[model samples]
Target: MSETAREAILTRIRTGLAQPAPLPPRPDFTAPVHPPLAGDDEVLAFAQSFQGAGGEFYYCETRAQLAVQLATFRERQQLGRPFVWEPAMQEILRAAGVAFQADETEFLAHADWGLTSCEALVARTGSVLVSAASASGRRLSIYPDQHVVLARPSQVVAEIGDALRVMQQRYGTALPSMVSLTTGPSRTADIEKTLVLGAHGPRRISLFLLEDE
Candidate 1:
């Protein structure tokens, strides 16, 4: 329009801007969006959700049990020798009388079963949060045909958000360059809408929940 109409609009806008508008109340970011599960309930929820996502769940009440269960699983599945680079996991494997090759070259050549430790486990979505910060880095969880994660009960959380918070506290300002959540075996339904597992990564993902305080 006209200059008169534009002036009138400008004057109205100026008058409106003279008065401050009330701001909406701030949200409580600390509050969880969903109800949180705790203790054994949280672990149980994770087991159920993880299994629903086509993940194998093994609950070991003691470290000895974890070792024996893992040894038996490896034998039964014929997974060959596992490749673990994490020092803690290597120690566990050694204690369990499990043979694992830690050489990167050997792992790359024979990537059969890869064992790793996870950052956190989400009970809500049954997702395992892993970071490149670990000695195993990124490949151990994805390259192997059979990927096994050894997690402690203390690492289980109620939801993804909770897991993220825990990670933040653990890592502080120097967070990992790469962080990923593996819900289960890599899957996709891209071809003719047919579901396919191991489409982009490991075909099988197993979680060994070691009951450690």
Candidate 2:
């Protein structure tokens, strides 16, 4: 084609492209549902359903109870499963033969456990959110084969929004690098119609609820 004709064709193409594409419809975001905290007993019951599906649970009232829990947890770890906890509980786990490491790299390779302080627990969803600023690195929860969390009943709330609000209030200026809301073990149904657990994260999750002595 001649230079003038080619130039004209290019200008037309540019103009057509500049006209802008039509926008798709917006998704609906409004819905009525109960908050996480609204149904405490029911949610706890639901969480319990996940038990024995390659998971465990413990309730404690004292340091001695903690010891017993650790004993059982240690047995699970010896069987090639991993666990997670809060740094505050490190000494107990250490006594139980579970190694403690601060760095995620070390923890992922050598340690079968991780420790993290949670921001809040949502009873409605049986979910807990771990802030990155907490002693337990975010990766600790997701990278292990099993997750063990320590949370007080008082820390459990009704909804996810309540947890977010607590985080905003507690950390007024600085927010955590990441906040993870984990309800159960890592799972996927992507493989040929079979539901598989622990695909991208922990295959099991256990919660230790400690009552004040």
Candidate 3:
């Protein structure tokens, strides 16, 4: 065969061997209504219930208050102190015992845990979705033994659809690298129909509800 023909045949063979599979369809999203903010006592009660399940909850009136609570938790949890936040939070974390690093590489390499703000929470399921585009690494929510999330009462939606719509509007064509629908801690019941926790993700999930602030 001529060199050109030989090359053509080889190219055809390679193409034939390659898999041509259609991509999975994007998730269908339907916006749902926001849920009314849980009463302070109700929120507190929910947190108390999770305590028995190895979870913690904190309530704050403002972002400042939440940051302070987080700092304290990090210290108590021995998750290393945070040094700097993006802006207003940096100092608070530093004071609480967090050591700041220069970049994400350092953040993950040394930090024992992480904290991020959430877009919304589903009151119906008590689930929260954290987006990677929000500058929060997926690992922050998954890799750590403990995950601390900050959510506002106003962001509590009635269903997952509401959260998805907020995401669609925020990111448009470019979806976040990851969207985690976290409800409680990771758990599984695979052995003898026995329930187990922390199978694939954090053993503990903490949420700070900022209502007034």
Candidate 4:
């Protein structure tokens, strides 16, 4: 059929059937809002949820204690080498006398441990949200044998909804290309219903929750 004839017929058909339909005034989506509790309530919920999902959590101070904690983890796991975000964590590790790789790609390929910061912690699900546009990118969130996150108590929100709000506020319209909500080490029970962890991603996920200020 000729392009002009096809266009004319399609236009006539569309006009014949078209009607202005106003969407039913978007029903009031507002529901009973129960805001998340602050202080220990949210913290406890997050800890319980994260632990239940096979994630390990730890406490750490900024300088000395943080260094000691990392050292202990390395000795215990025998991590081949560490890969960390440059300005965010590499300097801190160096100041603590720990060695790390700078070339993220090469390091990620060989390193067993990968360290980065999180955007926020979802207390309801005990998950950490991260953006690839952040210093670590999505690779730091998933492409490693072990994932270590430095989380502050202030970053913990009552639920995933709150955490997402924080992200939206921070990035505005230009958001990261990738955002990951990780609850624990990867897992799967697809084969014969036998549960297996780290089937798709990191085998180990650890969060060092900094003491509340």
- Show the colliding residue pairs in model 1: none
Count of clashes, each model: 0, 11, 10, 0
- For model 2, the stretches where C-alpha displacement exceeds 4 angstroms are 1-32, 35-55, 77-87, 91-106
Error of 1 at 40 (Å): 6.9
Name the top TM-score candidate: 1
- Report lDDT (CA) for all predictions: 0.89, 0.67, 0.67, 0.81
Score candidate 2 by TM-score against the native. 0.68
Better of 2 and 4 by TM-score: 4
lDDT of 4 by residue, 96-119 (tens): 787777666676358687888888
Per-residue alpha-carbon lDDT of candidate 2 for residues 1-213, written as tens digits (9 for 90 to 100): 999999999999999899977899886677546433334474364345435344465777776776677667777567433434455666655654554554445565654554455778765566778877865666777776677777676776666777899999999878888888886788889879799988888887877776643
Residue-wise C-alpha lDDT for candidate 3, range 96-197, written one tens digit per residue:
354554246666566565666776776556777887765555666777667777666677665577789988988898988788888788889998988888
Query: CA RMSD for every model?
Result: 6.0, 10.2, 14.9, 10.9
Better of 2 and 4 by lDDT: 4
Q: Against the true structure, what is each candidate's TM-score?
A: 0.81, 0.68, 0.63, 0.78
Error of 3 at 210 (Å): 2.8
Instruction: Tell me the deviation in Å of residue 112 in model 1.
Output: 1.0
Q: Candidate 4, which ten residues in sequence have the lowest lDDT sum?
A: 31-40
Question: Candidate 1 — worst ten consecutive residues by lDDT sum?
Answer: 31-40
Model 4 / residue 1 / CA error / Å? 68
- Flag the better candidate by lDDT, 1 or 3: 1
